[model samples]
Target: MKPPPFSYHRAGSGEHAVALLSALGPRAKVLAGGQSLLPMLNLRLADPPHLVDIGRAEDLRILRRAGDRLVIGAATTQSEVEYSSLTAAVPLLAEAVGYVAHPPIRHRGTVVGSMAHAAAVAELPCVALVLDARFTVLGADGVRTVAAGDFFLGPFRTAVGPGELVAEVALPIAAPGTGQAWSEFSLRRGNFPVAGAGVSLTLHHGRVAAVAIGLSGVADRPVRVPSAERILLGAVPDDELITRAAAAATEDLEPRPAADPAAHILPVPVAPVPGFDYRARVARSQVRRALTTALARAGGTR
Candidate 1:
């Protein structure tokens, strides 16, 4: 079905985009990449009265570094980042991009748009959580920076208040001796994982100096497991320790179905969990696998 009627405004710059959104009110939506918004519009899941197209906003089409963090603009496509030098600073973000749908989608899908979309199985949000990515949001009031933990409110929700749009995101560069790994179980190569795990491990003096674990498809929103992270920090992870950490990560993760998917009318996509126990098992094993790989790459193990 075609999307309902709407007024379109092509923004020439970031400030223009924000001003357009501010004037349009809450029912208005910012359009970038159109990878997520278009489909939702066509299905009538979202019927915004106005669309502020920022895809042509040159300022938001940037990819650069800020000191120790890699910054990505709102219009920067995932494919752009995947093949850019910025990935050298945060390889985990690049690896996660490879798992977001397929080549064509990534070519047109904006990274910040995916974060704003806030899909349950999206990999970017999970990676952002682990990498300490900061979202810069622009509104009529002004720009504000938000941490990943505070940015993601829940499934299909975010801290981006109405009249605000994400302008860019900054992800910290991994420290030396750090190993990053992403492990997920998807039915097909590009399909969203039923359960996914991301891990970054920094080894110093043969022990874990710093670590972060991010999980997707196991809960309502992409989440980081500090309980598991706490167990491995400053420790030499062995099989037993890894197993315990994995178990702790999934222990209280109540696997629930995605909800309020008004955009998907195709009999509702299959829920990620067949049984809660089975889903937890998959998520736990992913964490375990990610930890092992990260440890090996960090030179903590053979």
Candidate 2:
């Protein structure tokens, strides 16, 4: 089905987009790459009265390093990031973006758009959360920075207000001696993951000094599992320790039934295996895989 009738305005600049959003309020939606939004619009899942196209907003296409952080503009396409040298600054992000979708889709999908879409299983948000990224949002009241942890409220929900637009996202460059990895389980290439994990670790004197673990497709939002991190801090990187940390990652999660049995969008089309238990298991495995990979990269013995 075609999208509902709506007026389209190509924003001349970031300021113009903000103005349009403020004036249109809840009725207007900002269109970046439109990879996610277009699907929703086509499905009639979203029906806004107006669309402010910010794809041409040059200011929002920035990709640069500021101090110790890599700042990405909301309009920067995933493909731009994937091929940029800046990806080396955040390896986890680079690895995760590869799993977002096919090359064609990535060419048109914006990283900020994925975060703003707030999909529970989206790779970018999980990576952002693990890296403690910050999102800058613009509104009529000016700008406000929201931590990645607090930016996502739930599936398809975020701190972005009706009239506010996410202007940029800032991810801290991994400190020296830090290692990061991203792992996920999907039915096939270019499909949404069933469960995924991103891990960043720093080793000090043969022990885990600092670690961060973020999970996707296992909760209402992308989540950093402090419990799991706590289990690995100051510990030796070993199979036993990694196993315990992986278990901690999913120990407290409550499993829920799958949404639809008839939908083939996911690998498992039945509730029998796609329920909470299944996701938890996948989450555990991914956490283990990510941690192991990160540990190896950090020069720790597996």
Candidate 3:
């Protein structure tokens, strides 16, 4: 189905886009790559009065290092992230981008768009949360920063207010001896994970120092497994520790309900758990795998 009637304006710059959105209020939608918003519009889930296109905004497409962090502009495409030299500097981003929808979609989808879309099961947000990334937002007032923890509020929701557009994502450079791992349970390649895990550990000597774990596809939002993180810290990364952490990660996640959607009706999709029991089980399994992989990378003994 075609989207509802709307006015479109190609913005000259980030400030120009923000001005349009502020004037239009909540009735306006900012179009970056038209990846997430277009699909929602076509489905009549969103019917904005106007679209402020910022695809040509040069400042929103650049990637560079700022001080000790990697600053990536909002309109930067997923393909850029997948192939970035920054990913080599920090492989967590590369691993997360690998799990995004296939090449063509990635080529057209913007990183900031995905984060702003705020899908609970999306790989990028989970990775960002695990990395404790910062999100930069542009508004009528000025630019402001929001931590990953505060930015993601719920499925398809964020803390961004009207007239605000994401400007960039900032990732801190990992300290020496830091190790990261990402894992998911997708039925097929390119589909979102049924349940996914992102794990990062800082090692001191042979023990875990600080640990962060983010869970997806199992909650209203990507949730940080704080209990599991505590369990992993200062502990020897052994089978026992990994097992305990995995158990803690899946202990209370209630699987979401699923409708047997007709394949023809909903062509785009993500990993869906078979049932409540199965989803919980898969969450546990993914946690185990992710933590184990991260521990190994951190040079922990088997």
**Cα RMSDs of all predictions?**
2.4, 2.7, 2.9
lDDT of 1 by residue, 1-302 (tens): 78889999999999999898988898899898888788778877788999999889999998998899999999899999999976877978877888988999999999999888887667888899988889999999998999998988876789998889899999999889998989998778987777789999999998899999998877777888989999999888888999999999986666454442311212244343344465567889999999998888788873
Q: Candidate 3: where is the Cα deviation over 4 Å?
A: 254-256, 259-273
Report how far residue 133 has shifted in candidate 3, in Å: 1.1
Which residue window of length 10 is worst by lDDT in model 3? Answer: 259-268
**Which regions of candidate 2 fall more than 4 Å away from where they truly are?**
260-273
Candidates ranked by TM-score, best first?
Answer: 2, 1, 3
Residue 243 displacement (Å), model 2: 1.0
lDDT at residue 281 of model 3 (Cα atoms): 71
TM-scores, one per candidate: 0.94, 0.95, 0.93
lDDT of 2 at 241: 93
Ranking the candidates on lDDT from highest down gives 2, 1, 3
Candidate 1: lDDT over CA atoms? 0.84
Question: Residues 91-181, candidate 3, lDDT per residue (tens digit)?
Answer: 5777888888899889988888888877776788888888889998999999899999998987777889988989899987767788778
**Strongest candidate by TM-score:** 2
lDDT of 2 by residue, 1-302 (tens): 89988889898778889999988868799999999888778777778999999899999999999999999998999999999998888989988988999999999999999999887878998898999999999998998999998998977788998888999999999887788999999888888888899999999998889999998888878888888999999988898999999999987765656762211222224223367778889999999999999999988999
Error of 2 at 32 (Å): 0.9
Better candidate number, 1 or 2, judged by lDDT: 2
